[model samples]
Target: MKAVRTVAMLALCVLNADVPLNAADAAAVFPDGAKLELLWSDGEFTEGVASSPQGDIYFSDIAGKTPGRILKFDPKTKTTTVHCADSKKSNGLTFDLQGRLIACCGAAGGIQSVCEVLDSGELKPLVSEFEGKRLNAPNDLDIHPRGWIYFSDPRYGGPEPIEIDHLSVYRFDPRTGDVVRVTRDITKPNGVALSPDASTLYVAETDNGFPEVPGAGSGGGKVHMTLNAFPVDRHGNLGERRILKDFGKETGVDGLTVDSEGRIFAAVRAESRFGIGVYDSTGRELAFLKTPEVPTNCGFGRGDDGSTLYITAGKSLYRIPTESRGWFLTGQTVP
Candidate 1:
């Protein structure tokens, strides 16, 4: 595991400069000198990154308490393997529509569920408790073309004992194993996406006041980094909630991906602007990709590396070659 080729060059020296886009929508969303390529910086943080229906690249390397790893990056043998070395602490990695691998096992004591990564690698607990109370860690997920699995349970700092009192956005129905709690008006529901004709459901509330359950109380004060747009009917249920981008105090959006013209590729953890924003399913701001470190998730890469753009910053795994192209429920053509 040693493949790092720097050259973000301050992310192409802030390409699209200050992002008000007009140079042909900023070169049709980053193209002329797009660089950002770290590839693999070892990991202890790198969140979920998906992309595999032959174009390998599966991220997540949490390792806060030891059990977390799922690193398989091989854009044709630039090598970096160890796919699932006990990833109970996994954090979002999608691929359904039958290609399997749908995880979000948010750590704490581990196995905090919304899993299904089994081709013998283990972990197949699809919806780990909702009424019997157990989840509150399932970080990110999105896979609904009818197979519905939208997750995000938000706990963020775990030492354990949070039994899901509220902090939600879930919907797991793997055919009728049922587990719905769509969104309790999110105050802390990290990344999730599903709009490329799946209607719209882009939640990413990322409240960094972090303290919802450590001693039990305190994450109540200044909450709302915002980026919400829920309105998905046809039985997956969820309406009324349109805020779509509002990072008032800074540090919003942890992970989300939607391009296929329904644009939105946010990871933006705003330290003063720390990379990857690209919005526009009405959240405007169409292009900004500066990640030297601070991003947490982003994915797009399938047949022919789709349009390439796989990032999971800080303990690294970055890529950038976009002109936009990612909206997958498995293998393209979802209009």
Candidate 2:
């Protein structure tokens, strides 16, 4: 047992290196003097960070599968508190046009899928099944300006039986009340977001699986981790899979968001290069924001004119000033 544990530790250290880049990484995407400041540290695994309509920040604490909960941060107090004791272990989160908290809560229990948490503390089930069968797990999500919620359903580490034939990306249209499979080209999709113009869709192709049982998250170089982009038609359907960024042996990202100028901000999990990477639409590294731990997700703060970027990693939440606003935070409201 001791020998096995030693090997696993060594493997983890070996696999986590910087993502292979070209010879030309000369300029910085972020400001050269940029600094990341710790905002809070109160969870075992913090993730699913998002901003509310009133300017408050919301996130989830997975607590290593004991029981996940939702948390809220008030800018006025600069403090964090438990928003919902039962978050259903939701990972990635976003808000709808109605300012309602839309959560992808199907990952942990395999029971409740995507849900909308009202201000009254009521959890309304949104999408749980497709073609009369239960879902695998809904991981991350993003809301289109047209009221459609696009989410990635991938089994990371859980005891739930895989009900779906293949892990894919899905969009739930509130208007038609139907869930559309956007794309199945990915092995294990993790993060899902959109461009500012809403003309393109972004999905982080982490196609990696982490077993929820013992020895979970141990090194297994079997999964391919990459980021992909798909063109969006007028109807919100995907066009084709275009590989944007491939991490090869390095760990891919968990969540990603865009800025108003179409710049991509990815929460990279590669331990050796753990932090946030800012890239242009063409996949050119513009800047890199270093965090103290492996970042899982990020959000632009409206309080600072969208200049502040919030991050969720390990057991803490961090914030850093940026030059761009969130992709969808123009105040015109999402469509």
Candidate 3:
């Protein structure tokens, strides 16, 4: 019996050695060699992360078919709680200057809307339909310094429209609940973020429907990947479009965010290598943070004093220490 027990222990140790490291584990490899320790991973793919003023992380669970939910993660306790369930398949999320939770909901037709949960737990829909025409599902969003809210509405999920042109970007007036169409040129705008100065708006164009490339198959045929930079106005009017970066291999860019220094961190699934594509202010790929799960979105928030990179990947949330500060700022004022 003792010999059998010893053999069992040896087998267990060997199995543990073969297990792969998680996201939290990978995060610890940052500057101080600190990897992310899983806060709570129930095998549900958590996508699109946002932070509250109090330093809690909110993420969307988009893995399940029906019953999707938005969850909140408290860094202090390392506990995750369900914030809101039966969400409209909420994908990307952010908070406005007023600290109201803003989410991009899909499957509600070409009608992109913004909802803010009031203190009474009531969700107030700010903008639902755009230009009398429904918006093509809002994918991701970011807020500007001047209180204007910008979002991406790409109709890539549902069946292709047999009629309308398809997909556009929108800006919402938080004060008056008005929505405006800023641009309608990108083939599929997936991730959207603003520069530090709020002068440039970056949108990631990823090809969702395409042929499978033989030998070099990342997921599809050829990823017509590109990032666009747009000039914006205080009133949320975008102008002057220019190509920032183009990754022609179809490693489809998904959700993204910018740091305070104007660097873009985009989540890209490239040939089974799911990670982030780091771009400098001048639109150059600086470095890549590889991950085990396919990351959907990421954002910057302060933890342990300096800024930390919080990433949302398949069924888990992770964070790593960074040299820069948080992108989400307070009363310091930025224009």
Candidate 4:
């Protein structure tokens, strides 16, 4: 009997040793069947993933309360690096038509500011104030091919430490250096994305009423929740705001991306059954792609013949092949 037990224990040890350590299983917040391939994993929570022309992925690490940085992932080599530190609490990122990196930066007095990364990797502030008032906390941003940038200014991270005013979405024109407030109704607007044709802009309505999550947050709790979609105009102005959908108490929406087919993909919050929620062009829930972790954002990675879908959840980055590819590299003239 003792010998049999000993042999069984040895066999179990051997099996455990042979099995490869997978962080996906450890960090998964829900069930995932999309054949998740781990691109990178970190202890810091990641958000706002964007792909460059060369197919490299860039994301922000919002883990540290004081210090935040942007990380880059190289698909070919399967390696990740700290692309930039001291991002001034930058949360969202995207590349403009000219291939310049656009960031939504936050600081005590620099709330909802727009900045650009030069070729030499220098941060230059573009828009800091709108209408002579400090912009709120600019969370996530998306750029249209027509040199117009639309960013969400939720009070997620801002100075003055007040949450009384309304959260808004703003548009910045690269040519005229003009800034316009597109919408002022959203509560805690986050993660912004534009349609492939640049006619529509989507923003995540994370209206967790200030202070945040009661005991979960210091004073910020009550999430006044909803999602919104706005029409995009040529002069960097928004036409009309529309309700996309509403979320439950436990779940909210963040960082969004649109495919070449104009399908919107949003990262679902805590109570979401699926980490990533897929929506049709008409604001319908088409399908939900279960990710390994609680996805904060997603991006389309250009492959040789097709493209790959990259999702950034908790501490890991996941990828899966998609039937329809994104148009970031197809030279499609965007509005």
TM-score for all models, in order of appearance = 0.33, 0.86, 0.80, 0.80
Evaluation by lDDT, superior candidate among 1 and 3: 1
Best by TM-score: 2
Best by lDDT: 1
- What digit string (tens of lDDT, one per residue) describes model 3 on residues 1-335? 01101011100010112325443432322343444444455537677788887787888886445646677776666667777755566788888887888888765332245667554434566776776755556778988887877887665455423223455677787778777777766666778898888888998887664322222122344346778888877666888888877777656678888877677888877664557767676676655676657778888765553377777877777676665565774634455
> Which residue pairs overlap in candidate 1's backbone?
none
lDDT of residue 83 for candidate 3: 78
Q: By descending TM-score, how would the candidates be arranged?
A: 2, 4, 3, 1
Better of 1 and 4 by TM-score: 4
lDDT for each candidate structure: 0.80, 0.75, 0.67, 0.68
Give the Cα error of residue 41 in candidate 3, in Å.
Answer: 2.2
Candidate 2 lDDT by residue in tens digits, 1-335:
01101011100121113545432342323433455667677688899889987788888888665668788877656777777777777778888877789888865563548888777655678989887767777889988777788988777766666666767788898767798888866777889889988888889988554533222231244667888889998788999898888988778888989977788889988756877887778776666666767889998867554677888988888776665777553334443
Candidate 4 per-residue C-alpha lDDT over 14-64 given as tens digits, one digit per residue, 9 for 90 to 100? 012222434342123123333567766653777778888777788877765
- TM-score of structure candidate 4: 0.80
- Candidates 1 and 4, the one with greater lDDT: 1
- lDDT value, candidate 2, whole model: 0.75
Q: Is candidate 2 or candidate 3 better by TM-score?
A: 2
Error at 58, model 1, angstroms: 5.7
Candidate 4, lDDT over the whole model: 0.68
RMSD for each of the candidates: 17.9, 7.7, 8.7, 10.0
